[model samples]
Each structure stands twice: as structure tokens, then as C-alpha cells.
Target: MNSNFSLPNQKSKAILERYASSMSTSNAVSFPMVISHGEGCWLTDVDGNKYLDMMAGIAVNTTGYAHPAVVKAVQEQAAKVQHLCFAVFASEPQVALAERLKKHVGQDYRVFFGNSGTEGIEAAMKLARYHTKRPYFIAFTGSFHGRSMGALSLTASVSKYRKGFGNLVPGVFHAPYPQPYKYPRTAEMVLEHLEFLFKHTTPPEEVAGIFVEPIQGEGGYIVPPAGFMQDLRSICDKHGILLVADEVQTGVGRTGQFLASEFDNVQPDIVVLAKGLASGYPISAVMFKEHISTWGAGAHGTTFGGNPVSSAAALATLDILENGAMENARVQGEYLLGRMRALQARVPQLGDVRGRGLMIGLEFVKDPVSKLEHPELRDRVQQLGLEHGLILLGAGSHAIRLAPPLVLTTEDAKYAADTLEKIILEAASH
Candidate 1:
């Protein structure tokens, strides 16, 4: 903890206490540090403790916190105007951001704005169903789309998010995700299973679409096997079903590309983006191929979807990410992974290290003799990282997620990896 910072003020403490008692307890919190400000790849708490932010607000902040370019863009746009709904009159910032994203993705693309990732997911789902004229969707097990009803119905990660929320939007089916390390099923086997289900169970003609993360974010940052995405694309194409790539956490240079699908060079029919889109401002979007943007004018809309301020922030953030921040992610991400593997050699509990660019996962497993999950040891290691100066987040049932800002430097990555190794060693010894 830095010595220069003061603790949280009485006003802040009171507000937090009130929020805890009055607000819904459904909001699960992991870290306890009261974040006050963020810069680059680091965050400072009210008590003035500076921590290396490896989670990057759950893979947002691609341009890092309070970047000068984004700040200037927001300031300039705010001075002109802040709230101008796109429904009435399309603003320049929103239009520019769309064009920018379109250029990055492809020429024949259109964009729809929303306030969060779930909103974007909802829009994509609606468009898929409307365009295909089908009632069923094919999703993967251990996938996380979002938390809204439509998105929640599509999400198949955990039961807690869906518990008591039934009967959810029906016709959603979960198949095996292409996790080469964990699942014994190969891409062909999984696709064959999917084909079997579509033919025998749901009927391919009745299927609306298939949704996937280019890399599974919440489900341990699972990278699909080679040619897996291509096979899925082919499957969707053959069935005339839409392919929706949920790049919510993997987009914006988190995986060394504007969209993780770019790495495989397979274009999806629709891409859902959020988290890093507007830096810290709340904005998300569903980008669709020109042919699929068939919704009528009154079909769907949101009040704050593309507000000028958020658009400006998004535009500036995009500028920074496109320029050099993303490339940095690739270089530093490899360095971080290398260091982590070295740590793994020393700490046997750190079983697997996976993910691309800055979106990384370190899975903790019990001793090989037992081969079970070591949640107790994982908790201690995570707490030790917090006790030091790093804020590491957990993923899936037994893995730690490291999604630092793309702007993170190699030095910062080294420090975080080294600090994490020391903590894990101490915990393992205990």
C-alpha cells in the first residue's frame, strides 16, 4: 500500500454500507479494494494502494484508464454536445466509430449500439432469430454470453445465474465447447455430436443460430483447437444459420487482434462487442454483415446506446487500440506466458497456462496423485497476490484469469508474473 494515500472518506464508507444493505445481493464481489482511480495497467484504491490490474475491468480498458487521447476526445465532444439520440439524429462520433469498426472488421458491415454486453447479445440473438425464421439456438457448454434474459438463456456456464429464472427462453441447447485440453472430444467429434443433435433432436431447419466466443473467456480462456472455428463456420453456412461471435471479452486487442476471429481469419455473420469498446464508458455494439442487418427501423432501440459522450470515448479508445496498444499486448502477453510457464515448472499446482495475447488463464490443479481441483490452495494464492500489489481474478472452477490492459508494458507484466509466482510458492509451502 502506498503511504501517500488516505483511507476512504466517511461519506464513501456510508454510501458503500447503504448500498450493501439496500441493493440486491445478487451482485457478487471478489476484490475488496475500493478503487478510486486507474492509469495505464494499474489501479489505486481509496487508501492509496496501487495494484497491477491484471483483470482490466474484466477485459475492458483496452486503451488503459484515463488515456489522454480518450480524455481529449470526450472533452471535445462534451463541449459540443453530450446527449443526442441516434434515433432522432445520428451524431458524428457514433457514425465515425461505426465506420472505424466496419473498416477494421470488413467493408460490408453495419453496427448497432447498446449500453452493455448483454444488450449487444440480445440484439444479435434477435437478429439471428428474425433472419433465419427459426426458434432454436445452439450454444456451447461452459460459455458465458451475458446476464440479461435473452443472453442469460444463451449462457451455459453456471447454474447459479439461471437458477429460479426458468422457464427461460426455450429452444436453447448447449453442446461441448472445443476445449482441446480439458474435453476428450475432438472438433470433428463435437461437430458430429452437434450434427446428430440437429438432425435427431432439434432439426437443423429449426435452428436459428450458433453463438461462440472466439476464445472462451469465463470458461478458463479456452482456446479452440485449430480449424475448429472454420468447421463451425462451415456448419452454420450449410444450415443457413447465423454465426454470432461473442467477442465481448476477447475483442479490442485482448487476443492480439481487433476481433479474435481475425486470428483464424474466419468472419462471423455477427460479432457482439463490449467491455473495451468505450474504454470505461458504458457502450456495447452488435456488428453484423450487411446482408443480416435486415431489422426494420422500429424493431429495436435504446436511449443511451450511442450517446455522444460514450461514442467519443469509444472513437478515441479505438484510435489508441488500433495504433500500437494492441501490438504491445502481443509482445507483452508472450513474455507473461513464458514467465508463467517458468513459474509452473517450480509450482506443480499451476497445472495449465493458456490464452492468447493479454487474455490469459492459469489453472490450478491438485497434486497429480489426486488430480482434483485445489480450490483451497487457489484461494490462498489469490489472497496472497492481493496482499501483495497485484489484483488477480479467478475464472471457471479452478483457474486464474489475467486480462491486463493492452497498454501494459513488459516490465509490468514481469512484475505481475514474478509477484504471482512468489505468492503461489508461499501458499504451496504452507
Candidate 2:
């Protein structure tokens, strides 16, 4: 650890001042460190202070920072052609990526590329409504789809995200997401609530799609009870509603499986993937089953959605994932989970430690008995993490998320576990 280091050193401070003057205030700043560059699972600030990166650009860096293969692919693609709008012209890289996605999905799903997860969600919304001719949709409380008007309506993770953005898209209703840690038989409870919604509020026939996160990302990294997704699939099948999996955070082998939904053996009607698709490059894919691709060409298109360079990078990323990075995520994830759970046993304030594969969450509470959230302690842990040369981020209300790059090794995972244990101990004492 860099004992002499402090955040926002002179160089970082200067850059931050310039950023403050130039950038929009709406942009949320989680940490003060000004990064110089990153490699593997580590980042260095402008002041030359090194920090172990656990968040991985909010779970976007699948192959870690500037992996050689991804860089070479990007360079080669850029040398050939940067951008030739896929809407007007066919590109080899884009078509190849689409084919790869289809193969990986193991389904006859058609792909639609977009610039962000929100755009993918927006496209899914349009396709769902267009195909079903339905005006209503169902999402869950504490879910975050995105910020666009259509996606925002389905986003209920944070109230502030929707505050003042009134008159959101109509016909979107929310159901309670099951958190087994807090409430037992939460799957049954949520299913009962959905049934109630169908009976009292929204008609089953009018609902277009059911938007869900396989493992609710922003919602405290909450993992639902077993069979919850399978139950949802059955419900969707019964109601003629499309099941849309928002894999923006949990997709691309983050949760051991290529798709977290695979854990439950459920295949969603629509799947939206982004974040780690191109290892931080701007690209998202909204895939729907072949039967659901009812929209005609030109109905929805993006000029730069599937840029050649990004597609090449994605192909390289997929190669790495297929070869070994993905399996590394599984092994290291289990190792980290065991380390944290052991620590949890000794720490009273560490309320619950839950996750699947590399996508994990450590929830803090005032006490384990009551399990009351300790947001202040969570905040302290995140802040102190910076001083300890560990980069961290919080998810939901009182949980710290561990979403490091898929390239993380067992040794690095040990470093993260040890450092986080120290941070948690200090934070809990305070």
C-alpha cells in the first residue's frame, strides 16, 4: 500500500478543477482519484499512486485495462476503417459479432446493436410493444433498467434517478423483487404479488414484457431465491408476456455463467447486454428470440452502435473469455466468496455476504440480529478503501460490490480480501 499517498494529489486536483469547470454537474463522481492508466486489475492515478481496482469501471472491463489482444484488434480495425454506419452499409466486424453473439446465446435470437445499455433497453421496449401490441409492462421495485424515458419508467432502484423526471412512459407497473436474505420465501411472495397485480391492476393480456435483472445489480446485488427466474419464465409463458433479462451488469461471464439466467436454466425472450461487451467501449446488444423479431429494417437503427473498432475489440474480448478469463472469474469468485464469508462470521456488522461468481456484494448492518442497514458504515468502508489503495464501490443501500476485472488472479483476490477486511474492521469500529 502507498502509505504516503492521499487522494486528489496536486496533479489530480488540477485536472479535477478543469473537469469541474468543463463537465456537467449531473455527472456523478464516486471517487476523487484522477486515473493515469490501468493494467490488469490495477490502476494508477496521476500522482503515481497505485490502487487495486475492484469495480472494473462499474463492471465494464472484462479483459481488464488495455489487454493486448483487445488493443491489437482495435488497432487493426481502426487501420482498416473506423466507422461506416452499419445502418447504411454492411460491415464484416458487425456481422461477425452478431453471429458470435447468436452462437454464444445458444439460441436463434436476432441481435440489435446500440450505444449503451439504456439504448438496448429502449430498443427492447419498442420491440416488445410492437410485437405484442400491448401497452403495459412489468418491472420490479429496486430495479434499474436505464435513464432514458422508456427505460427510466422501468428503473426503480433509486428514487433520485427518477425524481423530477415525471410523466415517465405510461403502462409500467412495478412488483417486489425477492431478496431471500431479508425475507424468506421471497420468490413465492413476489409471485403472489405479481398474481395480485394481474388480478387487481394490470391485465395479463395487456402486459407487453417483464423486465428483470437475472441478479439485481443496483438493487444491492441481491440474488433471488432458487427457481425465481424459472417461475418468472413460466409466468411469462402463461401470460404471453416477453421476459427480458437486463444483463447489463451480470452478463458476459460475470456470474460464472455466460448469462446469469443460465444458472436457473431459464431462457428469456429478450436479452440486453452491455457494460462489459467491448471491455469499456460503447456497445450494447438487444437480442430477441427469432419469433419475436417482428420489426422491419429502418424501424430502429444507430449510426455508431456497432462501430467496426468496437466490434473487433468485442471479438477479441470474446476470444479471451472463451479461452480462460471467464473460468478465472468463476474460480476466483468462489475463492473471494469463501474469504469474505469467513470474515463475515467474525464481524458483527457485516450483515450479509451474497453473490454469484465474481459479481458479489457485502452488505453492512448496524447489527446482525436486527439486520438494519448501515449506510454510513458502508460509505466509510468505500472512502477508507481509497486510502488503503483499494478501489471500491457501493451497490444498493448498504452493500459494497466486488466486480473486479475477469482477469483477476487468486493472489490479487487475496490482496483485495485482506485489504477489504482491514477497511471493514476499521469502518465497523467507527
Candidate 3:
């Protein structure tokens, strides 16, 4: 391990023990750094060790940590007022944020604010059912909408997430998402299966909407074959079903595009935005086509939705993304992808490298010929790389996702790629 790399601190260990025994009912998993602050793409621990932030707080810090623009916006907004419920009264930050979003939406759309991606999903669910007056929804296998009751009912990634939480929200049906690599299911085949499901399991007339991620995030950063999203749009159009694009992880320049769904040829009726939308602020937007925003007052509401501070932060995030961060994602993302693919020649265990822009996934395998997943090796590589000042995150069981900030420079990209290659080789040898 490097000298700057963190070792297990007794102070942090004691704090963690006390946290576990005294803290809340929710469980949390964290590395042992005990981070004190973040700047740009680096994190500083309380003990003064520094580490590159490769995952961007799980793709939340789109403009990087403690971004000056976002911090300034927050400070300015907080100085005036922090909490003026938008539902009760109009606020400039929230109104401006909504208007700014309108310009980017490219179509007539209405915005609804909430605190997180799950809230956006929940709102989308209600809107879909209310608009279509239907009883069923269609989701895909390996999809992770969220952990909330409604979103959890739609999620089907890991059995552990659903275990012990039965009797979930009903009317959600699951279909297979095209893996392209694993089991090699073509888009047509997946759509055919969906048709079979509609014919036998649930009628199309009864389905309120079909929710899909443009690029599967928790399902291992899987990118569907070309024309897959267009086909989905066609299917939904034919059935009068709303197509909800869950862009929680892929939105706000993560995919080198405003919305990964836009990478497809069609427009979704509803688009869910979170994660990178407000830098690190807790805010989410459920954007819907004007025609689909049919519900009247008292239908759905959130107290913390469109908080002034969060809205200000979101506005700053948008300014950064639109001005240059988005283009940077495109260039740096291509650089990172090409470099990783180049490494595959020597690192034969690198099975598949895929993604758009910054949301890249590198899958590890036992060997080139066998192509069996090597999750254990992947875990070892991540831990060792973290100890070497390179941070990495896993997707699915065998893949590592590089969802870095849009501001990531070529030097940072090179360092992370080199460290990852070295770590992978070390893990393979072990």
C-alpha cells in the first residue's frame, strides 16, 4: 500500500462500533477512510490521506465534490432562505430550475420535484396509473428502480433486496433485459418474450407504463443493442402505454448525453432524473410529457420537494453540465474506454468493457476462453486498488463500474486505468 493510503484507524474503528450499536435501524457499508472533505475528484480522510473519487459518490457528484459553482449557489440560497416549501409558496430557485429544465427537455414537459430517485419513481408510478387508469406496469429483470415499496416492487435485480419483503406493491410484471454478453439475448428476443408475457400473463390494455433504464446501472452497466430503445418506444406507442425512462444514473451527462434515452432515436413520455442532477444535493425530478401530466391538485405532493437550497444547487449543476462538463464527459469518457479496451490485450481476464461516457463497466472473468465470472478476483482488485489511492466500485457480480465525475482529467483517468490494470494482474496471479 502507498504511504498516503489509509490503514485501519483505531479511532474510526471505535466510532464505527459505537455507530453500529447506537445508530439508526438502517445499515450502511463504508470503507475505513473516515473522509473529512472532498475537492474536485479527490477525498481527504481525517488522518489526511487522499484518494481519487472514481465512483463520484455512486455517480451523484456530477460536478465533482464541493464544486465552487454549486457551493456558491448553496451559500447564496442559504443566506437568503433555506426552507420555503414550494408547494405552499413559489420560490425563485425552484421556479428557475424548472424553467431551466424546460429548455433542455426539448419537448413540452412538466416537472415534479422530490428528494430522491425512488421518490421520482413513486411519483411516476402514481402519474402513470392516474393517467392511463390502468392496473399493471412492466419492468425488466435485473432492473433496480429503488428500494422504496413501489420501486422495490418494480426492482428485480438481486433476490436479497426482495427477500423478507414480500407482499410488495402489486401489478408489476418483469421481463428479461437484453444482456448481449451473458446468455446473448437479442433485443428482438427480449421484445418477443415481452409480447408473450403481454399475451399470456398481463394484457397490454391493463399496463399503465413500461419503465426502463437507458443503460442498466445496478444490472452491471449493460447497454442494450442498437434500436432496442426505439423498439421499446414503438411497443409502448402501439399499446398506449407510457414509456418511463429511469435516467437516475445515466442522466445529466453521465452517458455523454443529456439523457441516455436520447442516445436512442425516441423520446420517453416520462424521464426520471437524480444522482448527478444536483451535484450532491438531495433532489430528484420526475419529468413528464405535457399530455401525461393530467392529475389535478391533491394527487401527489412532497414537503421537501424543490427545496430552495437544493434547487439552487441543481441550477448550478445544470450550468456546469451544459457549459462544458457534458462535453468533457464525452472526451474523457472515450479516453477512459479506449484505454481500458487497450488493456484487455494483456489482461485477458477483462471479459467485456462497455458503457457510454463516464458510466463504464469493466467485467472480470476467470479466463478468456472460459469466460466465467471472477467476482472474487474483482473484489480483491477493488480493495487493493483502493489501498493504492485508486477508488473503484462494483456492478453486477463480475464488473467494476467507473462512474467518475465529468470533470475528470486525462491524468486522473490514466492513473486509475494504470492502477486498475496492475491490480487486476495482481489479483489474477493470486
Candidate 4:
């Protein structure tokens, strides 16, 4: 073998061995190739292999990598003032970003800035507890809130995530959510379970908030049936419990809309956003209705939550998402989902294809009759994409998630569909 051809791949392996953690992390179905650079919807590996990125850093990049407007805004903001520590000195960028986010939330809403989705969830939890003077919360099973203790307490997606983390935050109760593909339960049944929970388990009077994902992200990207959120909202209102939407993955135009909750006409009492808010910058927003403003000063504070540079990037990201990226999502998502539906009819392993906008999920099963989840096949299909210079991620038990950048074009959609078809067909044969 020629040494030149092997050099690039070997260098990546070497760097990973030397600097990266040894613990095996198999979340992304990550390929061995080291990324050299990224543009709109593509990433080039160190070995010069170009991959169409369908994961979009797990629905974080709203405007794509190194977007000109976002980059320029970040550069200019950094030159002016990178760190004003919003707690100490009021930052113009922070205030401007808050003003922009305000319109998206609603007229009578308040914004709390943080650095990640989990932090936002934490804030929402605190605010709910403080405002309601309640000690309990209701979180849906098969949901991924975050990894921190407080948020993790609300997360019930995978048992492995909470296996050994004993002494997990208490005061959190889990209720089943509707999953058509995996479970036989319907929205009505889930609502009944909530009713049972309120009666038998934790009393609604003691519950502060009910946390939910507008479109469940890690739990197979499952989107509950119509009227689910509406029913849940009514229940929350009836009990004086806050309805909290964990929009960390579905917010910021990932679902072809500003918020996935918007589609159901269900207004959440609190909205937690992060992933696409600043493209790739670390920023999370916890927006709540104005009525929950019982929080006083010194209750919560972060030193670097509202960094000026990140705020500028967020402002730029919103500009792009509103101007063009959102419409692209609205159009291209339909095209991609249509192709996937056609493919689903032809492929036996493809058990289900469902999602809204760009946040699609392609679920795999062992066979049509059994309908048993084929997680192995799902992993193989993901690996096949990586081997063929395509980037994608797996979610839940046996589903591949497609959450490409909002800027994905029709051409990109065609390429993704074609590539997925090729990959799935080849895997099926094996």
C-alpha cells in the first residue's frame, strides 16, 4: 500500500488515541474520519472525503458552519467586547438578543439566559418550583432532558443513562407518553395515565411543572398524535401546573417553524431552547410566562451565560433563520419526507418514517411481521452512511435521525435520500 494514501486516516487515528478519552462513546455512530472543514451542509474529512452532513451536530447548526453573517457578527462583537459578564455589566448584545427572542416567545414572557439545554431546563425547574411553591414535577418517560442531576432526574429515555447515578434528584415523577410505533398506547391513554398519576402518585397540587418535548428527540424522535399537547395543556392549567416545552432540539426553526409546539396550537408556559439558537455557539434560553416572575435577584446567576460574542452569533442566526433558512426547512423537509415515505414502502426494514419539517426519524425493525426493533441493523445503516461519506446519527432504540441544517437545499435533500436509499438497500441485502 502506498504510504501517502494511508497517512491521512492514520493521523486521525493517532490523534484520537493520544488526546481523546478512551471510554467508548457510540452515540453519533461516529465515523473514524477526522473532519478538516465544513461549509453549508457538507464536511470534508482530513483524508479529503466529503460527507453530506445530515445530523447537523444533532440539530444545533441552524445556519450551517461558518456562515458568513454569523462569523462576521461574532468577529465584530469579539473585537468590541467578548465578555461583559451580564451579571456585572450590562451587555448591549445580550439586551438586543433578549429583545429579539422576546417576540418569538410572546408579549408577556421573560427570558433567562444560560449556556446549554440542561442549564435552561434547570432554570425552568427552579422558576417553576419557586413560583408555584411546589416540590414535585411530572416528566414524561422516554424523554431526554439533559445529563445534569436536576435535569437528569427529569430524563427517562434510556436506563443506561441513569444506571449508576444514584441519589438522583428527587421530587420527579415519570408518566408514559404516546409512541405509536413502539407502544400501543394512545394520547388518550397517556392522558389517563397522567390522571391516575395525579390521583395515586404525586398530587397535582404539589407538582410545579410538567416537562415535555414538543417532538421527542432522543426517544426515537417520536411525535405524539394530534391534540396530545392540547390535552396536556388543559390538564396543566386545570391543576395550576406549568406546561414546560423542552424545545432544546425542536426550537429555532428545526421543525420548519420557530417552535414545534406552535404546530399544535399549544402554548407552553416555559420554553427551553439552545441547540440552534446560536448556530454552534453555547447558549440556552429559558423563556417563561410573565406571571411566573416570582424569582428574586440572587436566586440564580451564571458567570458566563450571556457572553457578548455568543449573543451576537445568536442574533445573526435568527436573522438567517427568519429570512431564508426557515422557508428552506418548510420546503426541503417535505421533499425529504416524501422521498423517505416512498422508500419506506419499498424497504421492509424501514418500520416507520415520521417527523415534522427537517426533524425526521427513520425507524428500523427486524422484519415486517415481528416488528421487533433492529438496533443492530440501525447501527449498521449508520455505519454504512459514514463509510460512504455521509454523516448521520442514530436515536432511541432503532431509529436514525435526520436533522440537517435549516439551510439544506433541494439538491441536498435529493442527495440525502438517494444516499440513504443506496445505504439501506445494501444493508438489507447483507
lDDT winner among the candidates? 2
- Each prediction's Cα lDDT score? 0.85, 0.91, 0.88, 0.88
Residues 256-291, candidate 4: write the lDDT tens digits: 889899999988999999999999999999988888
Residue pairs with clashing backbones, model 1: none
* Tens digit per residue, CA lDDT, model 3, 52-87: 988999999998888899999999999999998776
TM-score of each: 0.95, 0.97, 0.97, 0.96
lDDT of 4 at 15: 57
| lDDT at position 192, candidate 4 | 90
Query: Candidate 1 on 1-430: residue-level lDDT in tens?
Result: 2112223346435555666787677766576557789888888877677889888888887777888898998899889999988888889889888998988888898999999999999999999988888999989988999998999998988898899999888999988897666555688998988988987888887888899998998888888887888998998889888889999999877888888998778899999999998888999988999998788997889888988899999888888877888898898889888988888889878877887899988888787445578877777877788778888888888888999888898789889978987898998887
Candidate 2 least-lDDT 10 residues: 1-10
What does each candidate score in C-alpha RMSD? 3.3, 2.5, 2.5, 3.2
- Count steric clashes of candidate 2: 0
- Candidate 1 TM-score, C-alpha based: 0.95
Ranking of predictions according to TM-score: 2, 3, 4, 1
Error of 3 at 425 (Å): 1.9
Clashes of each: 0, 0, 0, 0
For 1-430, candidate 2 gives per-residue lDDT tens digits of: 1122246578987887788888887877777878999988899999999999999999999998879999999999999999999888989999999999988886589999999999999999999999999999999998989999999999999999999999999999999999887666579889999999999999999999999998999899999988999999999999999999999999999988899999999889999999998998899999899998988988889889998998998999999999998899999999999999998998899989989989999999999878888999998888889988998888998898999999998889999999998888888887
